[model samples]
Target: MPSLQALKRSARYELIRAGLEGTALALNFGLPLTNPQRGVIFALHHVDPESPANWAPNAWLSITPTFLEQAIEVCKEEGLIPIALEDLPERLADPQDTRRYVCFTLDDGYRDNARFAAPVFQRHAVPYTIFITSGFVERTRSIWWKTAQDLVMRTDDVDLSTFGIDTRVNIEQRAERVALFDRLANAVNDAENEDTAIARLDSLAAAHGIDPLAITEHLTMNARELAELAADPLAHFGAHTLTHANLTKVDDKRLETEMVQSAARVGGYVGAKPTTFAYPYGYASAVGAREIAAARQAGFVAAVTTRPGLLSETSGKAATALPRVSLNGFYQRKRYVRALLSGLPFRLRQT
Candidate 1:
């Protein structure tokens, strides 16, 4: 884990790099620079803080309910109108429609999204989208991160020699545990195959008496829970692919299966065919031209990437793979989020 001073310095550096100081002026003046006429899709994951400690390695995947509510208020205060992701294609296509819109999209169907985040959206009457990973709802895939987290927290020591570690590792201290989780994550991402990498993690977790799928069962909403939440008029559903696989690493057939079947599965639960999609892991390494093309081939009208950019006019030209700004869990402050929505940092040369 990073020390308080180190974390503060890193946060300050990011704010400066984002040109956050000028964001206030841009917003106050109603500069075109701060406008969201082409819209900004904010990528999010967990809205409920599952772990309160500083030792949480996946802390970036979560934000407090207070922060979620504050974020909604801040967006409205900054002159961005809340719109459903389903409306994005039409809004982007209309050259005459100049209204600035903010589309809140949460990836991975966490139960907290329905339990915690939904109430905030309901109270404010803001529209948002939840991208369901069907395997998670069905508890069929190993959510390696969550599994690793529990194993590290529960066990004082672990042996991963079979997974490339030369010796047993100890995680007595909080920082050591956090570091261990990060190391496990890096090993997976750096592996030749994502599933093979995950299999290794699963085996390691099982050796330590952890059931990876059970972690998924505990963390995510099931099919019935998803259906109940889908009943909310403010809540819209999108497909996030089955098993949340690294699309780039999988074969073409696997890619098509994940996309098409996941969308179909989510539609079955949500009672509406999902027209929009969110790529799993949504990064360049995970989702590329091939994955984006597959999303279009799967019949989605719009799909979002984790690529950090405010949507612009020409963005509509590529409706299938639109850029999105992550409401990163690391930077949950209203000020940082405000700067992101302004479209200034990306426009700045330093970025």
Candidate 2:
């Protein structure tokens, strides 16, 4: 059974989606009623077309390569100039500049980013930032979500008793698989020791006939690939913590270690310390004043949350708590992209 909070969130998202679709025409052409600022930071995860079928439990986290290409083209067509993340401060500082800008940021340093997405970005000559979790690149930590999904999809029955999850699930059923993944993923996210929870999950996955580490090794960039990506002029590396741990749950010492060590490791690959940071599982509860202060102390120039809103002059002041709109998998249509970038949906929601 889905938690009440999860159900409520799903309902809220559906309402927002309906609003975006309903007000698409007015938003695209009408005078802007929201913030006058003309810049957007897009957050994305997986960018490869792993399956032809678009419907999946984790579909929202991914967009096909074709969709990515079309999105960039749509932005260009709509007169939104592609700008590097590093250039955003300068652009935001210039109040006189009237041109719209978009900055691309891909989280998790997925291997597919290098294999599939990078080529598309390169062809379009767009600059992007890839936030890497050092432990993921070092293979010292596993992507719990991926491991959970694989276990749920591969086995008809799973014994999650070890994780204190006493739920009956038939993985063969799509709905059950999604629900199971949600429960397990949420548990991992809220766990006190996320690393231990993930390690235990990996053990369960191995016992059920799959090596989670081996499977996910190909999903994220390795140290060598990170170095290569950092060398690309179109690409910039950012810290996403050492283990992708939620900073809010850890003590001050551990929190600093996660932030500082991750930046240092990426610095080794990029030849300079990363100036940007993306909070792991970036949500309000996962990050707050403490995390923001830590990012500043770690010497990050900017930090972005998964919050949905447009960037404005005021946002420049709150660089550490900056908002970004996800190029969500559910809203894949080009018109939807225009509506989101318009800042109208978020504005109307506020009203």
Candidate 3:
């Protein structure tokens, strides 16, 4: 594990490079970098410090307020314009002009996005899209990460009933608990029923003498709050399904309902027909070429995944099924961003 100081330093460098300053001469360094593609969509999750360990494989890649500011400056300086997913069809028709543009999108509809991220975009006059999952919107529950963090921090013990792995945990057990957390979190993440997962969390908290409901309340956003954000021109809504289930594991009918219904419900509340879809736990194993094509079949213009890479004109129209680098907590190094954009640091997992 990287020390907090090491992580912060890494983050500072990424901010410098990807944020406006590094972009100025970044391409000249002969890394496999490309100018902002016709529609390079940025994917982000939570911005809340309270929710540190995100579901993304490496949460450190997430941008801080400082990094976000730099990113905004870089976008404007590089002449990378923003567009909504609804505008993609028309923009794609005029490829040359669109290739240099960028779009900002957030997944999971966390409150900090509206509370923190939106203002940054607004201050820069950039438009952004928020892909919301209805379960969290109506329920106002703590998201998975915050729930897990609360379990780890608030209690001196934890029990993993769902996985049949029960144990007591505390600060001294921080390293061990994080390892255990990852193990159980994966099972919880992979489970079809969030309730089953929650029950396990409840059992775990109970074992540790923590209140599960209190923990749940701290993680999610409510419908009313999402509605207010939808009112903003810069804020557009998209589908993240009713429940955050892995779409690939479900049958086609259920998948469509999850994909289409979530879009419709969020549309009704947000007052706009969403045209984009972001696959939950989007990756090669969780979703691939077929699932992405299905999202398009469901009337979406684009679908996004967690696969790390760039989207270029040469990348294909299925660029709708584009791979995005997760802006998470784990990615702190400026060199990492340089490597990612230059196409040198990370590679897609070959399944």
Indicate the residue-level lDDT of 192 in model 1.
77
Structural similarity to truth (TM-score) of each candidate: 0.90, 0.91, 0.79
Q: Could you give candidate 2's per-residue lDDT for residues 1-351 as a string of tens digits? A: 554555775787789788778667776567554556767889999887764243345668888888889889878977788987767766676768777788899999998888888999999999999999988888888788888878887799887666666744456666677677777787777788777778778887887787877765878888888877877899988899998887888899999999999999989877878889999978898899999998888888789899888888777667788789998777787878877877878877788
lDDT string, candidate 1, 254-283, tens digits: 999998999899999989979899988888
Q: Which prediction has more favorable TM-score, 1 or 2? A: 2
Q: What is the lDDT of residue 251 in candidate 3?
A: 81
Instruction: Show where candidate 1 strays beyond 4 Å.
Output: 1-37, 49-51, 349-351
RMSD to native, candidate 1: 3.0
Candidate 1's error at 52, in angstroms? 2.9
Weakest lDDT window of 10 consecutive positions for candidate 2: 50-59
Candidate achieving higher TM-score, 1 or 3? 1
Clashes of each: 0, 0, 28
Q: lDDT for each of the candidates?
A: 0.82, 0.81, 0.65
Order of models, best lDDT first: 1, 2, 3
RMSD to the native, candidate 2? 2.4
lDDT of 1 at 299: 88
